[model samples]
Target: MAATAPSQSAPLAALSSTATELDVRDMVEALGAALTDAGIDGDLRGSITLAVSEALNNVTEHGYAGRAPGEVHMVVDLLADRVLVTLSDSGHGMPGGALPPGLLPDSSGARADLPEGGFGWFLIHKLCLDLSHTRHAGRNTLRMTFPRYLAPEKS
Candidate 1:
């Protein structure tokens, strides 16, 4: 799949906060509200929230290791048929070529060890329309997109 460049347009809501679990929830709520106000449905909103949470958690846990104070930048864009959220952080980048796994393995009759970590990426991929990650100049950028879908609430 072709990757698009980072958006230059102003986000509906841009939040900069210290990488913390509480801050992640606040950012998700703020972004979800902005998208909903822009006419996105609740289902999409939930998906977007999950994707954003996963991205932010990755930055807080792996990127910064929750040690030093680092900035987590979140931007939400309302598009014609989708909502896009881009999260950027200035922290240690993932090891070169260490992309997250695409999907979770089937659990039926398969008992896999849970110690190996990669489930966040799997969940992000499953929840959002599309996700792209990039690291440049020690900054990690994650873009998550949610397609506009009419939820039961709208019907």
Candidate 2:
């Protein structure tokens, strides 16, 4: 299935959910709202959302492709000066069992070369302050952090 930005789900402030197309959107939105409600700035929320969306999208479109069912778990933790998002899935792990090094998208690529859609990981790498990936016991886990002060407060 093609990927599109997901709609907001009911306010759940979710800690975890099954990683399915039917539940991904709601989980993302609820998490986003929870962050903002906790006093994190909107810019940070957007970056986190973009990164999380990309991660969840990958889990859906790549890991669980062919509509195969699996568990994709998300856990958000708020620290004193930063937020942590940990995502886990029992589907296929990232190619080579680790994140590629310095894989930020090349913006200089020509228009035709840009037709392929893989900007998600690039944004995740660029936006996230800290990113860690590990595959253990058939579960692939990603942990990313964004400092609370990185995003400026809204006017």
For every model in order, what is the number of clashing pairs? Answer: 0, 0
Kindly list the per-residue Cα lDDT of model 2 for residues 20-102, writing each as its tens digit. Answer: 76688888888778887877646888888878888888888788776666778787776657777888888887878778664
Residue pairs with backbone overlap in model 2: none
TM-score of each: 0.78, 0.79
The superposed Cα distance between candidate 2 and the true structure at residue 56, in angstroms, equals: 0.7
Error of 1 at 24 (Å): 1.3
lDDT of 1 by residue, 1-155 (tens): 55654455566788999987888778878877777787775676776777678888888888887578588999778676677788899988776746576567545553564435567877777777666778888788888777766421210
Alpha-carbon lDDT of model 1: 0.74
| Stretches of model 2 off by over 4 angstroms after superposition | 1-14, 102-110, 152-155
Q: Which candidate comes out best when scored by TM-score? A: 2
RMSD in angstroms, all models?
A: 6.5, 9.7
